[model samples]
Target: MKTYNLAFKYRIYPNETQANIINVTFGCTRLVYNRFLAQRKELYETDKKSVTYNTQAKELPLLKLELPFLKEVDSIALQQSLKNLETAYKNFFQKRTAFPKFKSKRSTRKSYNTVSTSNNIRVEGNFLKLPKLGLVKIKLHRAIPQNYVIKSATISQEPNGAYYVSLLTEFQRDIKEVPSDNNIVGLDFAMSELFVSSDNQRADYPRFFRKLEAKLVKAQRELSRKVKFSQNWYKVKLKVAKIHNLIKNSRKDFLHKLSHELVTKYNAIILEDLNMKAMSGVLNFGKSVSDNGWGMFTTMLQYKSMLLGKQVIKIDKWFPSSKTCSSCGNIKDSLSLGERVYNCECGHTMDRDLNASINIREVGRSLLAY
Candidate 1:
């Protein structure tokens, strides 16, 4: 049996009362998380003792007695908050992330988690039954798979004040077999184009941010003119946040569609392992580099490929892909970014990005052969 993890996200509509309850839950969860974080920090500083999940969880009942508002929210949500903090600590010890920090009430992104136990969570018709908030209207965009077991749900409020829930589920399914005689392609990421494929296909960059820069600048300026913490300021802040959200959603949609198309057509995909951090540090190109989201695109490709039983290869960052002649295998002595066309001494010439993609394909084939 092959076990897999799946997440189903959906938009939710909460009434005024439910929304208020959600807000209170968010605040209470934040308070509990910060309190425990402070406790752990003090413990570590004073006696070099590390605080674990069990130790903190044991104190929750006592905490609720003192802070009665915490008891009003779902107990599971409070426990889950502590669990999140513990997970953050684990990540820090493993060097996967920095140390955990206290959550802020003023943060636009607020969320809490709750596990589904004994049918506490369910979807009926067009509503989702959560622990504290009962039967909220939900836009069930897609049906949940029959085999999947709902484990937990993360309720979050976005910057634009839209509410969403991501249901984490688990199931077992057989992995798709990778066909032996399958089409392979290489991808070259560029600023002008999102990607160029070895088969001469080009996906033009959608420049979503550039298109909205003018509107964003105007909105931000208007926001700056408002008095801090005033009603006008709050309204403008939401407007600016909505515009930013639009840009982010558009970019994410485009990337997901492109990655899905590639994974669908090719049995194997190859790409250069670019140092995105170093690329972003370059003076003039930093904004473009960050806006392209190369890292996020690659990550999506990798996970999607894994789910579909497709192969993805990453070549060394130092590989002279643009400098090497795809036809003759001769490495050029000098190549500049300004040279959009690759010219090799062996009388071979082609579009630079296309040529590099072909070289990446060749490298991937060689690696697979071994």
Candidate 2:
């Protein structure tokens, strides 16, 4: 099977012309998204929502027809914006969810007008070729395959004033026989540590946020001293963003490595399908929650399991595994986060995470066997 994959962290340097193209497409995409979101909000608030795609297509030409300049940017982005509105509405109404909120004007709310599929783009020895952008002078630190059907390429600017192109690709792999029944492990997630496994192995959080907390606060204080929208203020803003980005990158590296090891070493892995969105509401990690990388870890583990042909069993969130005693088949009445050790009145004693992990693995194995 040809599966889509992404090659990230590729350095890019777009000349003046390319930069103009990127900016134009990005502005066009943002405008369309904001307009579509406004339309949806008005539809939900009032009753008249006759804005169908066919009508949009017919009406959209009139929008750019007089100006004609807006059409210079990629038309594909406008279509996708309309498609997103349709799909989002369908999902919300079918599931009976609240009307989708309008897109925020905050910078983070914007999506880039990147290529639909980055795999269609390619990097030759000295030059990178994009479908629309053509061959610009590309620097290759490593050799990438010259021939592959390009899908889409998203070129983005980072807070550190560096540019990057994320090319999504597809490739055929020679399937290897999955080594079944190799090793089964269960893992427990926590706040202080990244995870503790059933085999008594533990991976602690790198604590990047904790380490930089003092420095980040100092930077914010300095930033506050600057006048709003001034050059110094913008510089301070970049400083804050850079530090946050550092924390994010560190956490991602740790999570990716940990997930890779777990998936490779164990044939069957058991973990809770943690409701991170819900958990975030209850936990006070400040901005660190976004940088904690728990959600990213689980997402990586899930996909790695599928890609490697391993079994990843998501135990129910309310399965009582944490409060259950693995030694004597006893379930405790209550358990708190402070309890590092589990002591059962039935003469069962074990570490809290260890016991929980054992229960998870046992329950998962039983489920798989059945």
Candidate 3:
């Protein structure tokens, strides 16, 4: 049996008192993170010394004494904030991410993490007990396994003013790898459709953002007309946020369903290792790319495939999948994006995406043979 961690998110409805406490916790966590970050920077620049989580954790009590408001919220959340700052620094040093920035109060998202200890965090009937905020009502749409241990919970408030808690749970399960057979498929990323599969299947993803673009624009225009920071302004702002939330939820729902179908149907899924960020910026395809949610779809496929003992293979991004003729294996000098149909001198013709998917499948098959 191998240990695995999974996060199950549920909508939570907290009483007014609990909601106020949660908001306080969010602010306190943000404050602690920013304060420690500034201190670390100043200390490093003046004394050529680095600060670690332990050093910051040690000073947390002193900070609470100075600003007693911090003591009113969950202590674990504060420690987690420090740990997050440490991780940010580590990631920056490793060249995995940019340097951490101070948290801004103006940011629409607010969240904090708390670890579970002594059964402090748990689900009872329709209520979830969180640290310092006991028994907030939860949706409980799905039941967690009895054996799975709750490790931590991340409480977040969205721009739409909805509360959610993501419970991180650890469990042990045996994953028997399925033998690779002929049940393999390749996918070529599509801007309009989500993907084109090797078997000529199209995801036909409904462009959620594009469809809702006009409504979002109208809402934003109305919001801009409102007096800034007034009650009406805030109400209009919530309306705008709700529209964005709708788009996001719709896109995620479609991607999840499609990924589930793909994972269940295929033993091995192949794709191109695409640089989506570069693609978005370089070609000025930001709107189209973002609407498709290709990156999110691949992430879902990866974890779902892993859990099911299936496999996802990514070929090199620079591979000439689009340029090469699938029928004769002839490589072309260049291919233009305008040409939706692929043509070769050898009298072979095929749809560009379909041809690419075929090449991707062949490459993946060859890789598996080794």
After TM-score superposition, the amount by which residue 214's alpha carbon in candidate 2 deviates from its true location, in angstroms, is: 1.4
Candidate 2: misplaced stretches above 4 Å?
1-9, 39-47, 94-110, 114-120, 136-149, 171-179, 283-289
Better of 1 and 2 by lDDT: 1
Query: What clash count goes with each model?
Result: 0, 11, 0
What is the C-alpha lDDT profile of model 1 across 241-322, one tens digit per residue? 9999998889888888988998888888899998887877874777687667788899889889878888888988889988
lDDT of 3: 0.94
The regions of model 3 sitting more than 4 angstroms off are none
- Per-candidate local distance difference test: 0.90, 0.73, 0.94
lDDT of 3 by residue, 1-370 (tens): 9999999999999999999999999999999999999999999899999977897899999999999999899999999999999999999999999999999987999999999999999999999988898999999999999999999999999999999999999999998887768889999999999899999999999999999999999999999999999999999999999999999999999999999999999999999999999999999999999999999999999999989988898899999999999999999998999999999999998999999999999898877632
**How do the residues 303-369 of candidate 2 rate in per-residue lDDT, one tens digit apiece?**
7876777778888888898899898888888998889899999988899988988888888886553
TM agreement with the true structure for every prediction: 0.96, 0.86, 0.98
**Pairs of residues at least 3 apart in sequence or in different chains that clash in candidate 3:** none
